[model samples]
Target: MIFLLSILTILNYNSNSIEINNAWVRPAGKGMNSALYFELKNSSANSDELFKVSSNAAELVQLHKTVNKNGLMEMKEIKSLKINGNQTIKFAPGGYHVMLIKLKKDLKTGNKIGFKFYFKKAGIIKADAVVKSY
Candidate 1:
């Protein structure tokens, strides 16, 4: 019955909410760039759209997608990311991610950054991005 109760507890959360897990930011190397990764579990029983992402450490932030064109991988902006009912979408390196633009400072290991995720249904969620190696 605990499993069923767990289900109910999750469902009882905000109707437009998402559970974010493994939230992290990449440690800066020679470059001033960093990437944020997370797993977003949609338990709202409906679709949701991720509209924007932002952090105080960057001048600009955008939802990015890695596309391979002729074996060359390039990053591009994604206006809206869709999440299906009761599904988890992972944002990680070598795949879709949140691009932190124009670093304010170098992100070192053990450091952390705070981010806000804005969505159509969920409104906003504040999460910490823990720095770690790739």
Candidate 2:
């Protein structure tokens, strides 16, 4: 029952709402840049766009994607990402990610970092991403 509940919690959101699930940040040394990965779900009837991401733990925050070009994997900044209604977008390794640059301090494993994400229609969402080695 607990597993079902957890799954439901991750999957379900009210109308015109957004939620983050399994949010995690990579562990890195002080002053080093790290990345965050998560699943963003939209349960709205209308499409939503992610415009900006911010965090106090890093000097700069950006949305990035790892693309394969000429057999080389390169990270590129993405200005915005649109999430269709009832869609779930995965920000995983080797794919779309949140880039946290110039860390204010070392992100130790098992710690949670707070972030504020701005959306075009959903407004600002505050999330806490856990730090992990993976």
Candidate 3:
């Protein structure tokens, strides 16, 4: 009975997982820079921290946020972002986004790119983003 309860607990924890949706990457040429946007939803009862992001599409993948400093807009790199329980974070334009620096190759329209998101509790969450010209 103890073993059965343990199994059920693990299953329930997995069911309440983080969800990534509407992931998309901007089109860019080789050696150029691009950005990725997505919506991250945390459904678990506990809050999570997103610490790192990685991708093979670019040489460097970093978390960044657009800020308006002294009436000038600038992009700044952030160490980590916290997602509250049952909350949704939108990584869109003029907000938090993933910077894809030094592209390995041309990302044309409809091309797909894979990324890995490192979290504190949910572990590594893999997501795919389509190349688009938004």
Candidate 4:
């Protein structure tokens, strides 16, 4: 499926060996919340940890995960995420995702938002996510 392929691409790289693919953000109005999804691929022999995420488009950007708590879906903030060497991590709906809180401006369809991913080993990896609607 297309969704599976997109996830594969995201897990495909940060530095020379870590690549990000199929990065995107959900469209939202100013002062509203949005979410970013992507695939992070680690191709190096060494493992890496994504400790932080930053984006000027929102007042606050944090790593989050959706969980089923007592049959109710809840979103929780996560401190960090790890991706082993030669592995891939997918940030998707109902899973691990980036929470964009309090948008500074409207994220319309086709708009691009800049992001910086902080990794323990890879350092800061800059990426742009396209605003889209599912």
lDDT of model 2, residue 65: 98
The C-alpha lDDT values of all candidates are 0.84, 0.91, 0.92, 0.92
Write down the TM-score for model 2.
0.87
Residue 42 error for model 1, in Å? Answer: 0.4
Give the winner by TM-score.
Answer: 3
TM-score of every model versus the real structure: 0.84, 0.87, 0.89, 0.88
lDDT of 1: 0.84
Tens digits of per-residue lDDT for model 4 on 8-122? Answer: 6556633778788899999999999999999999988778999899999999999999998999999999999989989999999999999999999999999999999999877
Model 4 ranges with Cα > 4 A deviation? 1-14
Ten contiguous residues with the weakest lDDT in model 1 = 8-17
Steric clash pairs (candidate 4) = 10-39, 10-40, 11-39, 11-40, 11-41, 12-41, 13-18, 13-19, 14-18, 14-19
Per-residue C-alpha lDDT of model 1 across residues 68-96, encoded as one tens digit per residue: 89999999989989998899999988888
| TM-score of decoy 3 | 0.89
Residue pairs whose backbone atoms clash in candidate 1 = none
Q: Between the candidate structures 1 and 2, which one is better when assessed by TM-score?
A: 2
Candidate 4: residue 113 lDDT (0-100) = 91
Give the per-residue lDDT of model 2 (tens digit) for 1-134: 99999777546543338998899999998899999999999976668899899999999999999999999999999999999988999999999999999999999999999998898776789899999997
Distance from true location, Cα of 19 in model 2, Å? 0.6
